[model samples]
Target: MTQTLEVTQAAEVTQAAEVTQAVERPLQTAKPALGRGLLLLMSVATGLSVAGNYFAQPLLDLMGRELRLSTTMAALIVTAAQVGYALGLMLLVPLGDLVERRRLAVSLFGATAAFLVLTALAPNGSILLLGTALTALTSVAAQVVVPYAVTLAAPEQRGRVVGTVMTGLLLGALLARTASGALSELGGWRTVYWVNAVLMIVVAVLLRRHLPKLHTPAGLRYPALLRSTFALFRTEPLLRWRAGIAALSLASFNVLWTAVTFLLAGTYGWSEGAIGLFGLVGVAGALSTLAAGRLADRGFVQWLTGAGTALLALSWLAVGAGGASMWWLIGGVLVLNVAQSSLLNANQNVIYALRPEIRNRLNSAFMTAFFAGGATGSALTSIVWVSAGWTGVSVLGGSLATGTFVLWVLERVRTHA
Candidate 1:
């Protein structure tokens, strides 16, 4: 009886050991190293994904004229896009953790393509608004691709990777206005959406073929995952601070972009092509992403944030003078782009470092707040542009930037304290 009991205990222990090893093997294995080709693809795809939302910025006037809508009604298209993007960031981005990223991204791209076509064919303001909102909502695929890129990158190289990918995103955003303007000149505003819908389809196929499959079990159900995302803001001061900074920074950014179209078209009497070409001035700022990322990797994140916020506040001075001189507007746009990009990169680096396992959730929390500010700014800028004109818009943007700087100072003091 004693011998039989001993044999039974030994068998049970051996079986437990086997089960432990099986569970641990996958955890211990390292992911394949990310390649430059794949990285570039992701960067391009991210840019393309986000470009859909901004196509209306430069074309708002043309759209308004053709659709027989008022300026306020046309501006609401921008607001709707931002609001939809914010909601998507809050809702869909968290699914990256729960689902396979490639499928989620590819599905979003396809859906965006479909909606862009809908937007192109819309006969009236109501349909256009619906299509634009749905298109922007699905465009959060860019947000998903961002964290997915971070996951593929090595820990030491994460900052550079983020910068490279973000550069693509920024370019897509700034350049979309240029493309829309040029395309509108060539064909019309509707042509811009048709072309982009095709581009989205092409990119979706490329991503489906090239993006490696990665699935990390989040172990929580949908509702719990969402609850956990919001809970992060309450528990993590870093997340809260970063999220606040993101909101203010984006608010300032949207304030400028939302109103600048009106300024250029009405005051300067610029052609759509010329206004589109103006977006190129901000290309220099987009180029700052790589340097900002490298700097963040080297531990200059806080300094980058401080400089960016200060520069953002000062850029409004140039922008205020833009109503009088094109040169001032150009300089203001350049500085504003650089400042916004640097601030955004630094904030992302900070939050991404906080909880590697829950990056999607962190991103959802941060970007939701970020785009909420953008939506608010776009909405207010339309009202401000009507009520107070260029000076009012500048004050609003500058005040938001200044507020961000103050928050950064407070964060710095708290850290030291």
Candidate 2:
């Protein structure tokens, strides 16, 4: 009897060990904690990627003068980058799963740097357009690095981690306008490209050193991979709804930017240097991005969605009230950016919660739509600015913001039902 009892006890202990080992293995494979310095490095790289994409925005006027292009033609410089970025998201970001992410990031950095140089050297409008397109396409390194950061972070801390990275990204977007404007005024528009070229070269080197080797296990075939991207469109109703809102929200954001520069420069006789200061005030929005992320993590996702949407709506509504005063315009711009960034962070937090394996692909799809809409907004702004001026631009932009709110309601209804 004693011998039988001993054998049974041993068997029970062995079973418990097996169960514990099964649970431990996955935890072991999870990414290690990211140090503060590494997070900061990622932020800087992301910021540069954002800044590079916008180098042509504030300089559109200079390009129009130098290249003998129309307003619509000049606007292409901004849209072309958006188009290229969309293409990269569609074609390149998914490879995060098939290749070593670190190598992929470095290679993208190099390609983007090369394109920046080409942009600096372009002798005519066509060559410049080509270089801008290439630079935008290759700037997918930002997408690569961001998702890589998400993967490396602890799941509980993912929102905060992503928020920090986005703060950097938003700063880049804001400062891009200021820096590009200032540099263009002081040294000519072409100087913007020269500056970007040098910065990208430095970013590539830092990425090579700071980012750890990232391994991605292959899970699907090429055709299957493409199919998976589309599947998100079909299967995830919330993603679809939120992505639509994102497109419209971003459109509103871009419309303001693409037209405001021209309006300030043409009507107000503001120099590039003066116009850049608008971006300084816009930097206040970065705080919203961080706040939204923290809010989402605390299970206040619904509240964030509501508050952000309301703020966006108010931003557009303010334009109607502030048509002539610079103070009002500045206030509206700051509010608009804050609302957009907050909503963006909240939306991304929700999407990231859906699937861990396909986060990269998912980001690509959503960001592609997000940027494509921005291109459309910019294109529309150019045409509208030429014909109707600031009033017309504001009317169009306000309508887009209102549309985003309607979509937000639809999302809320769907979630409840």
Candidate 3:
């Protein structure tokens, strides 16, 4: 009886060792190196996720006419979307550190798809505004995907990876206007949302299948996670400076985008399709993202910021001239797009370097400030457009650009000192 008992005990110990090895195997294996194909998929997903917020830009006029909204209310739709996005940056994005990133991203993408349908089916202006806000709020999945991509890349290549993904994001944002206008022309403004809703679902499925699983539990609970995100602004001066610059750059960007539809549709007498096609002009700016990323990787970030800010200020001059000459406006837009893209890439490169472990939190803080500036610009433009017309809008955009330049100068002085 004693011999039999000893054999059984030995067999049980052997099974336990096998179970331990099974658990340890995955932890010991290295993750596959990030590939160009996977990187492109991420970029495409990022772009499509952000596109929903922008679809309304070109469709504002048609939406207003159909919904019987005043000009101010029509413009507020843009503000609502920006505000919602800001909220998401603060509230939802930080959760990336607390949960499985792939699941967080996929869930947000699916939610955005549902919200797009809600926006498309709105029966009145109020519903439309709500839907737009919800859609924008969830569309921050784009931001989540960005840090996820960064986490997968080697430290040496983080800047280039960010730039590549950002290129897709910028394209989605710029092209949404074009797609909205063309789709609206073919069907109606509602069609733009419906079509995008479908696209969101498709991207969600792709992301679910391909996004490698990564869960780095930030150890902090939900409330602490949020507190730490806010704390980053206080502790990291570089984050503060970059966040401020991000705000002003995006504000200037939105100031043009929000009011330009009014300028083009009313002043130039352009059709929806024509105004949409004009967004293609900014595609040239998106192309600069990859090059800017490469430059940042090489340690030319400060020079990039200075040059970009100066170019931004100069672009407004051309944008102001666009009031009479389309050629001047086109030139201005090209410069503005390049400046904005380059500055954004530089800002992110520095911040991402500061804290690799909490990139999502860093991104949240920076983007919240960024979109808040966008919201402010959209709101200010609506008011300025009413009182001073296109000239007022031009002055607003130029002032914001100048402020950004001045801020960059201050940053240089302070850092060098």
TM-score of each: 0.88, 0.86, 0.87
Cα lDDT over the full model 1: 0.89
Relative to the true structure, how large is the alpha-carbon lDDT of every model? 0.89, 0.80, 0.88
> What overall lDDT, based on C-alpha atoms, would model 3 receive against the true structure?
0.88
Better of 1 and 3 by lDDT: 1
Instruction: Report per-prediction Cα RMSD to one decimal.
Output: 4.6, 5.7, 7.6
Tens digits of per-residue lDDT for model 2, 167-247: 888888778877877787788988887888788888888878877776654458876787788678899887798789889
Poorly placed runs, candidate 3 (over 4 Å): 1-31, 61-76
Task: Give lDDT: candidate 2, residue 236.
Answer: 85
lDDT ranking, high to low: 1, 3, 2
Q: Point out the worst 10-residue segment of candidate 2 by lDDT.
A: 22-31
- How well is each residue in 1-417 modelled by candidate 1, as lDDT tens digits? 999999999999998787566533432332353688888988998888899898998788889999999888998998789788888988999998788778999999999999999999999999999999999999999999998888877777778989999999999998888788778878999999999999999999988998877666577899999999999989999888888988999999989988987999999898767767877888998999999999988889899999999999999999999989999998998899999999999999998888766789999999888877877887889899999999999999999999999999999999789
After superposition of all CA atoms, the RMSD between model 2 and the true structure is 5.7
2 against 3, candidate with superior lDDT: 3
